[model samples]
Target: MRVRIAVPATAANLGPGFDVLALALELQNEVEAERTGEAGISVDPGPGAPPELCDPARNLVVRAYTAACAELGAPADGVHIRCVNRIPFRRGLGSSAAAALGGTLVAAALNGAPWDEHSIIDFVSGLEGHPDNAAAALLGGLVVVTPGAPAVTMDVPEELCAVVFVPDLELETALARRVVAGAFTRADAVHNAARCALFIRAIATRDWPTLRWAMEDRWHQPPRSALYPAMPELIAGALEGGACGAALSGAGPAVIALVAGAPEAVQEGFMRAASRCDLRGRSFVSRVRNFGARVDLSA
Candidate 1:
């Protein structure tokens, strides 16, 4: 039997909603798995996959597949996996989320296990140490995830497009998170709460003016911004170039601008900002994907 899984890339935080909000992108990673007569696992890495990811024993997909099998009380079996990766790794694009989902789905399909969406989310969240990216990758659309609760998904406006700027410098999530303060004052907490509420409503109602205010964050972005000095300029340029709102894509380095109409100005804004900072990077124009992870099985 064979199974094919497709998972979308995700952008988490969305400014004020730090660690609680995420949106799935049209960019995807595809994985194909087949059961083998032998009793070992093999993985073929896709283009741009890091050298470390090529090892089956240490790979995230292999670990996830093993975990899923254990969860289902199924014996570990031989499997061959081929990954066709497009999402940039470690750029806060939920590449890990895609890897985990792909492996979990492959295991479930092979075992004929009854794994529901929530179950999958719970399992992946445990492995990922956070739910934002995993929830967005699994459920798609715009997702709000809180611990001890099921992820809530809402439809993003079809007109909205994401203009992403990926910088050459890679920022690890651990390093990005290390710079943040352990706590926040009540005033700052209240401020973020208000903005998160506004952000949700603005997206739901397509209120561009309100969205501009909603994306203003005082918590994570400010502290993390120190690591990416070029980010502030990029965001300012995006807004100046007609984006409804813009924010750090995940941790640092990458920035995403939400736009309603043409993304030409937004794309240019990213390039111009990079030039001003004397940094080199690439830009992507992507749409919001309403569907999340999906799998197909064949005999």
Candidate 2:
């Protein structure tokens, strides 16, 4: 049997929520897995991607399949997987989650579909060691993970635009986690909680001004900024260029600008700021992808 699955890259912990509040972006990855009698895996690389990404064992598709076979009793023998990857790695994009979810979905579908959505979420969460990106990749749109019971998700305004700035260097999530403080004061927690609530409200209502002020956080960005020395200046430039709000998009390296209506203006501002710093990299002008992961069994 053959199955094809697609998952969108996520921008998680939007601002201050830390382990919650993930949003799906327009960037995506697609995986196709077919079951054969052999006991190996192969990946067909996407265009312009490095030659090494095509290796099955090193690929996330193989990791997902191996993990699923170990945990779900699915047959990993003779699985040929191919990936069409569009998301950039280590740029605060949920590239890992997208690959894991896409590969898992393909594996499960090929194995006669034993797990439900919630079960799949749990499985991927375990594989990724976190739920923020997995939840968004699985559920789509805006997902808020409660960390205890079943993860819950809500559909947010899809019309909102997100301007993402991807710097040249890679910012590893593991390294970013190390820089965060071990604990926070009760007052600080209260502050972030209040702002998180307001941020969600602003997202639901599509209120730009509310989001601009409500999304600022003291939890992770401040401590994490030492790695990216130009963060403050870049953020300030983004705001000056017309972004309503900007923040470290899940760990760092890439900063997402929340713009109300003018994406071009935001991009120009970000470009101008980068120019001033003599930095060069790729930037994405995209909007929220309300629809998360979708599979077509009929195909």
Minimum summed lDDT over a 10-residue window in model 1 is located at: 177-186
The lDDT for every candidate, in the order shown, is 0.88, 0.80
CA error at residue 103 for candidate 2, angstroms: 1.5
State candidate 1's TM-score: 0.97
Flag regions of model 2 displaced more than 4 Å. Answer: 48-52
Separate clash counts for every candidate: 0, 2
Using TM-score as the measure, which candidate wins? Answer: 1
Q: How well is each residue in 1-299 modelled by candidate 2, as lDDT tens digits?
A: 67878889888877788888888888888887776678677678677566777777777767887888777776677877778888887788888888888878887787677788788888888878788988888887788888667777777675678999888888888888888857467877888899899988888788878877777888788778887776666777788888888888887678888887788887888888888878777678877887788876633
Best by lDDT: 1
RMSD of 2: 1.8
Measured on C-alpha atoms, candidate 1 has an lDDT of: 0.88
Model 2 has a clash total of 2
- Off by more than 4 A, model 1: 181-183
Q: What RMSD does model 1 have?
A: 1.2
TM-score of 2: 0.94
